[model samples]
Target: MTEKALTIITQREDLPQLFGKRIENQAAIEEIITKIETESRSITFDIETKEGQATCRSLAAKIASAKSTLDKAGKARKDEYTVTADLIQVDRNLVKQRLQLLQDEVRQPLTELEQREKQRQAQHETKLAALGYLDVQDHDRIGSKFIKERIAFLENTVIDDSWEEYKSQALETKDNALRILRPEFERVKQREYEQAELARLRAEQVQREQQEREERIAQEATAKANADAERQAQQIAQESERKEREAKEREARLIAEKESAELRAKQQVIDAAKRERDAIEAERLEVERLEANRQANKKHRDAIFIQAKDDLMANGIDEETAKQVIKLIHVSKVSNVTIKF
Candidate 1:
């Protein structure tokens, strides 16, 4: 069956069309593509022979020529359509711009109303947030007194008709802010109390340590004083004992000297008595020795005289004359007239 060829339906005032119809050569281009595919299958390329290569190159030239023709035709047709499309786009842009202007003009009052409503809502939200605004930041650093003041201020704030439609919400926000602040206030107060209690405990501990140190020092002082007193007493006792011993030694030495002096005096008297007795004995012995020697001398002289007298009698000498001669010689009266005796 042969289908009818399509045609471009540009500039059609038919049925309020929004876009142009397809190009007129579209069906003919499809038939041409089918015919080219069937013909290309019949043309074989044998690159092993020179004639075959020449034939293949001739076929490639023909195909390239056909391709160039088809490209030019397609580009020309596309250019014609592009010019029409560009003109339509210009008209469309002009219509859209005019419609946009009309639309802005139509919505001006509503836009103003919407803007005013948005501003009113923003103002309402800002006022409501202001009612609940907690200016205290850094809860840990805030003091308990400041927290209390904030709570009091929040509790006393009035939610009146000035809030208008958001009065209830404002009141609720203030109450919620108070509820949050009151607990924080109590927590801060508790922390402060705990810190104060800890400080008090530390102070007590320091005072206790100081007291114990003082007591220990006092005890040490007392013990040292007692020790010093004991040592001093011992020293005094030892000194007293030493002095007493020294005095006793001195007394004993004095007594010994006195006894030695008396003994020496007695010995001197005994020595004097012995010397007198020895002198008397020596004098008596000397006198007795002298008397004995005188007697012996007299006996010897008488014997010698008798012997001489006997010899003289025998020789015609008298005993009385010999005795006279002996007496003269003994008295040292005769010079050369001594007897032999």
Candidate 2:
């Protein structure tokens, strides 16, 4: 088939026409691609090596079988071709389909491998350039050295066995390589997964720490607020106490002043009463002295009037004069004495 027709056939949606089986091994193809990737990294390629040559020979055999089947189908009689084409097509198509499937499956993985190799080569070039040991023209020298080393190793290794033993040994070596490499690859992947989980846990821990710090700060703020409130309350209580004390002092001062004023009023009343008693005593003494003086003066006046009447009677006077003198004496006796003594 032409390359264009082959491409169309591979891209066709009808699976039975292109591939022999109804359900193509798409998942197996993917698994094989992964296995190839693992093997490419660990196993070195040696075109001259027996194992390498054997793989190439098997692929060539499959191609030859497909071509022979196609030739036979085309050369058969028209009636025979019609009946046998379907059976021949199934066998021929299976071989071609497997080859195409492997190519398709390896294409993307091989591209990825090439990219990785380029990056590695670039890094190596950068390092070698820094050390002044790299030459762009001599890039294939390293690949030539690797090929020479593989050839030398194959030549030196002795294989003294029948074809069956050699095949068994080759199979054993392939199995051993897979066993060793598969575990190592899995370990590397597992380590990467573990590192990712560890990073997530660390992030969670940091968030928890930040939350705890915030809670601590809030608690401290609340405690400080409570303390400030308590202080304010204490200040208010103190102010109230001070006001109460001041009021009590003022009340006491008023009581003392009022008591002092009352004492002064009582003292003044006592002094006035004493003064009134002294004035009444002085009036009584004066009245007693005036009564004694009046009694003495009246006694002196009575004695004088009696002495004058006796003297007038003894004298030889006219009857009328004597009588007048006696009359004066009797008048003095009847009238109240006007003594000025």
Pick by lDDT: which candidate is best? Answer: 1
State the displacement of the C-alpha of residue 117, model 2, in Å, after optimal TM-score superposition.
34
Model 1 alpha-carbon drift over 4 Å, by segment? 1-88, 130-143, 152-158, 244-341
Instruction: Give RMSD (Å) of candidate 2 vs. truth.
Output: 65.3
**Candidate 2 per-residue lDDT over residues 1-341, each given as its tens digit:** 22233223223233223222223643222232233333333433343456654544443344334344433433342234455455545554544465455444434444455577687766644533332222223233233343334334444444344323344554454344345444444455565678789989976875676556555655654565556555655655666577988656655654565456555545554555455546655765787799788867655764554455456666866545755665665667536643232
TM-score of each model, paired residue for residue: 0.40, 0.22
The residue-by-residue lDDT of candidate 1 on 1-341, one tens digit each, is: 10011011111233112212234623333333334334543555455556655655554444444334443444444455675564334434433443344334433444555687788889989877666645445455667887788777777778898777888898899988887888888887898999999989976875676556555655654565556555655655666576988656655654565456545544654555455546755765787799899978877876786676677678766756765666677677988665555
**lDDT, candidates in the order shown:** 0.57, 0.47
